[model samples]
Target: MLKLYDNEKIVLIIHKHWFVMARTIATFAALVFIPPVILTFLPLATEQFDIRIVEPATNFFLSLYIMVLFIFLFLLWMDYYLDMWIITTSRIIDAEQHGLFNREISEIPLQHVQDVTIEIKGFIETFLKFGRIRIQTAGEREFTINFVPHLYEAKEVIIKYAHEAQKTQLPVTSN
Candidate 1:
């Protein structure tokens, strides 16, 4: 959970679509089955080797490999699942997970948002309705959220909130 300023309400919470994680899931699935399949064939290929020693050694190494693969899958899922974009009434927060330890969080006030660009590249992205959303702020910094689902809606929401924030900041004129 994230801390919010007074009167600020979360308008949207965005995460990368499930399709974005498909490749990682597929790789992990393959890792779980592929190594064992290869190991099963190893005994046939190396029939000349002594079964007494090789069996124990191979089992030990296989267990170690599976353990390492599980750790890798866990880290990969954390990287994908933890990264998020939070849009609030007052600002947009970008929370990125670089690894298990390193995380970066940045915010841009709604008033500072100059432009929102949505790009849906490739056939898969277009078909799946997920793409990249780039937010160009009034400052030098830009924030890009990739593989975001419902990008058009996100852009519209940002624009709507930005306009509202800008209007609230305007000076009142005296008659």
Candidate 2:
């Protein structure tokens, strides 16, 4: 949910590649089985060592481990869901979610955008049509959005809006 200017329209909204979240969920699912496996072998291991461990204690510790794991997954989901790049008719908004408490937002008027480059690094990225978009601006700071899907289409849309913004708006001048 983003607020827009009266005249400004949203040109595009980009999220990280689906595979990114998919990978996270997959890893979480795999880890959820660990407690079960450990529990299954706990009796045997304890018998072999002639060690007496309370069942209630073991269950309690495993439950705690699972709770912590769930918290980690929630944090990751927040990061993934909150992080995005918004391309509006007037500007580009980069919203970065560092963790649960911190976020940084950067805005560059399209008129000041100097270049937009797309980088697809490895086989997985290329095969999945997801990569990074580097936006170079006339100002000192650069903006990079990672794991963007439909790489070429996104680049084209950004370039198009940038060109349109440039044509309609005058460049800033220094005194």
Candidate 3:
């Protein structure tokens, strides 16, 4: 849950699809099983090397490797899970987690939004119904939300909000 401004209500919280996390998940799964596979071949290596020293060293290194892998995967998951685009009734908030220590959060008022572009490129992205949404603001600042699911719907929502905000900001003239 993220903190919101006074009177601001969240319209949508968009995150990258599960498909985007698949590669990292698959790689982590593969690495988790690799140690055992390599251990199976340890006996062959023991014929040339001393078992007493090799066994303890191998065990220590493998344990350290697994610990490192777990930390790496956890960080990767955090990066994916923490990064999000929050669209509220009044504005859009972009929160990006570069690493455990580095994070950036920016917000753009709905009235500042000038254009919303949705790009569904490549066969996989089109087939999966996930793509990139770029919101161009009045000051030429572009906020890009990548690998977002239901991109068109998100774009439509943003456009609707922007129009609403623009209408409210317009001055009423007498006939």
Highest-TM-score candidate: 1
lDDT of 3 at 7: 63
Predicted candidate 1 versus true structure: per-residue lDDT over 32-71, tens digit per residue: 8977798879989879989898888988988999899889
Regions of model 3 farther than 4 Å from truth = 48-60, 170-175
User: Which residue pairs show collisions in model 1?
Assistant: none
* Best-to-worst TM-score order: 1, 3, 2
Error of 1 at 37 (Å): 4.1
- Select the stronger candidate by lDDT from 2 and 3: 3
Residue 90 displacement in candidate 2 (angstroms): 0.7
Is 2 or 3 the stronger prediction by TM-score?
3
- For model 2, the superposed segments whose C-alpha errors exceed 4 Å read 44-53, 170-175
Error of 3 at 137 (Å): 1.3
Alpha carbon lDDT at 63, candidate 2 = 89
Compared to the true structure, candidate 1 yields what TM-score? Answer: 0.87
The true-versus-predicted C-alpha distance at residue 39 of model 3, in Å, is 2.1
Clashes of 3: 0
